[model samples]
Target: MCLFTETRIKFRLFEGCAAESGTDGEVVLGVEAGTYQVFALPDHGSAYGAQWVGLTGGTGSQDLARNVVVAAGEQKDIHKIFMDRKGTVTGVVTGADGAPVTGGTVAAVTPVIGDAGRGRVAIDTQGRYTIDFLGPYAWPLSFQTSTHAFQWSGAAHRRQSATLVPVTAGQTTTFDQQLALGTLVKVTATGSPSGRYAVAYNNSNGDVAGFIWVQQAGGQAIFRVMGGQQVKLQFAGGEPGQGWYGGTDFDSAKTVSIPATGEKVVVYPYS
Candidate 1:
């Protein structure tokens, strides 16, 4: 991700009134005793980021305005915040034997901030892929392919140990990874409304390995997963607070063993 600094600041304060920063990038606004959303436009002006403020405090996030509260006759001071910039990543995928991996999708996965930094790109026949509009952050990137195999730059197998890659604003970073031969499992689901269904897997310690999302065709959906390891499946979509193997909620989602044979696993939702 990138960072952009602008001299002028514009804000949509507390419901209706709008304010602009002076030459020194400062603004004073009189607001009522209620929460308000603060939105600003960057240099590009295509995207807007927002933060929320209130008489008591404020909260913020990427590409979103935060909430703020104000009390009666109270004064508040706001600080200058940095805006997120964009970056691009280009790469290629290959198999364990250095052969091109075809017909699979590649994703730049980051363990930080939960899946917020994850971006995906399709692998072309020649195994080339690109993930763009990424935020500038140095973190561990795990390259996950369609078969749930992880790889690192200049490695031949799944990346158990990886290093942090730095991405700068408005710059392109090249990262190529090789996939290892892993067990395969054919997963299908049943007894749910027709829509896109996902089967997510996590390790024993509850860390996400990968997830397979497929549109359900005729009450059945077919997807593939790397097998020979213990994985837990959390069914997303169709219904809520139900369909877990041994529990009643999505948080307590079920766990199953994908045998070394890489056999098929069918989920019977609400069954």
Candidate 2:
């Protein structure tokens, strides 16, 4: 006889416009009176895949076409969301020196479906990780470690150029990766408002590399990326005049180059 550890699966309720996480398999949401389609997502690392409410199987967000009508001061109960088992991906993570790398994570993203079908898991002491549940499709995997810059599969730095791993239902696929050293970039924001602020970095391919929140005024955030990569930064919330770091939009935004020894930059008021 063999015993396997059980993974706890959490649920999330989505209505195409807003989404909220559920506790203990139940969710209560407050929305304006309207007609909407509901979608349910199992938390990452679960053995079950996401699906639309009222349907047992749905491949994408577009399949969430069933509508639930809501009126003023009305309360409704959506039927139980049926979860289906999805594909699994298991792999080992090693450093450039060819040794097992511990204390990191592996993540999966289905670009076509966006965040609706994403999953992640932590690497164990043996440098092994498993994304127990993911939609059956081609997905790009991201390997992240403290000592290395996060890299997509095939050692590509950006998602657009990374290799896509194919997955099948009720099956497990193996992928191994060796991380490369990355440059740590620190960003400090001054003259920020008293609330939280979002800072994100994007590549020319329009792919977001990473993001962190600045909790207070003059707070700092940090991320790692491959050296020589040109990326743009975006700041959101906290003040009236906040947008792209250097320009009004992505196309016109100024780019910063990451160096081998790392770099530091400051975001001033209105910039």
Candidate 3:
């Protein structure tokens, strides 16, 4: 409960002189994701080299630097250690020559996340792009637009936002997209037969229930029971979790594989 024990953590970004030079800029530091205490002296050729890292593991004390301590009541910016250990700022990527480039590479220089989490996405025909992942590692990404390339290190963060970068999920981000591009697939019931059916969709995991249509869009629609095994297409009309037919509480859900790129199957149900 003593204010004297209050620890101040500071972080510094190693950016580039992209203003003058046109090379791939670099940002380097030693602070981990959390916080730390520090003393900044003039550069000594090497970074805060060999400094004692007393990080305790949690987001609070994981990357605490040793040998230096900020006085109580006085907070110092020790950001010199934890760089892009945050999120990301991405939209469209262009070339130095001001022309659109395709397949231009984007590498996370400071992995706010981890190596496996290093994000890389292809620039579309329109030069629009999105970061795959950005975590706690302040790894500034290196972008190449034709002969022109730059790094976000030296460049001041564009938006004066919460000062904290947040991660964007869903690796399947759309490129060159303005609106939500919904995909459409066609389904044919054929002589499918009448029944109670449940439809499932694919996601990062395996298969999950998306929408459970009773019949085809227009056939006899009714709430149907769903099971864990395969999606059931019970022929008998019944409420969800009830017997669609006889001994069969709900007819057996046909255990089958749903194609990834084609249309989902739709079964018809009788009244």
Candidate 4:
């Protein structure tokens, strides 16, 4: 199993600037002149974990990263980052019919500074999966299979509603998932510009059910939502700019009610 671990490091330069260091152990990044916090994250499944420039033990927190001031056209060398060994999570994936799911993926998401630390692994033929090299923290797990809708660890659809699994270094945690059927929602956007648009379905709790990109104006995109769930549709990056369906903003947007599986909902033009 150790051979399957990925040995790459991701260097984050504060905000959104990032660079990847491969097996050669070298990385170069160009950024604007400013004060930035530098941190490195080892790829998921690696025995090593994430850490700041000067911090060891793989705390995986950006607050611990050292602050460095860089002037325009000035080159600075960040010290080597040291990481500690991480934990592992293993489980079995089963379908709604109580049978083991043959093929799929399980992902663990950890909330961190700037961006979340994520690790994903494929389920084997026996429906077993092991996510290695996760920092010691409470993580939300997401399961996806070709025949079932994506679901969180507690069989919840939203991240906020899912269960948080605890992980500890030098130990293994067990987490299992059972999937449920999802409702299919088809949205049609008309009277918009002839460009790609992203349609997102957000629930009342501000949790996104799913999103898809429409290739052209008047085109349609489909995504899955929970059955009998009420959600609001938000459109972005198209002719009329970003806005919610039935209204210009989130507060005024009309709520869409999803029917059962095999049913479809068509969203008309944005007013």
TM-score of each: 0.50, 0.58, 0.24, 0.59
RMSD of each: 10.3, 8.8, 19.1, 7.9
Worst 10 residues of 4 by lDDT: 1-10
Candidate 1, 1-271: lDDT as tens digits: 1121111111101222245556666666666776555544222232322223222322222213344557799885555555456566677788767877775655433222123232344678888887554445442345555553443444312223445455566788887777655545444545544554445454433434444555554244444444545565544554566444456653565666655444555555543
For residue 138, what is the lDDT in candidate 1? 45
**Winner by TM-score:** 4
Candidate 4: pairs in clash: none
List the candidate numbers ranked by lDDT, top first.
4, 2, 1, 3
Estimate, for each residue in 1-271, the C-alpha lDDT of model 4 and write its tens digit.
1111111122212223256776767777666787766545566447775443433433433334466677899998866655567778898888889888999677653212222234457899989999876667666677766576566788776555668777788899998877776777778767655554444444545544555556676677676666656777865663343546787765677788777568667767854
- The lDDT for every candidate, in the order shown, is 0.47, 0.60, 0.31, 0.61
Rank order (by TM-score, best first): 4, 2, 1, 3
Compared to the true structure, candidate 1 yields what TM-score?
A: 0.50
Better of 2 and 3 by TM-score: 2
lDDT of 2 by residue, 1-271 (tens): 0001111111222223244454556666676787766544565456765444444544423223356677899997766655667787888989879899977768653221123223457889999998766666566677766677767887776655678777778999898888876767776656555454344454556555555556666667676666656777666663344656667666777787767565646564446
lDDT of 3 by residue, 183-215 (tens): 122233333344534333221112222223444
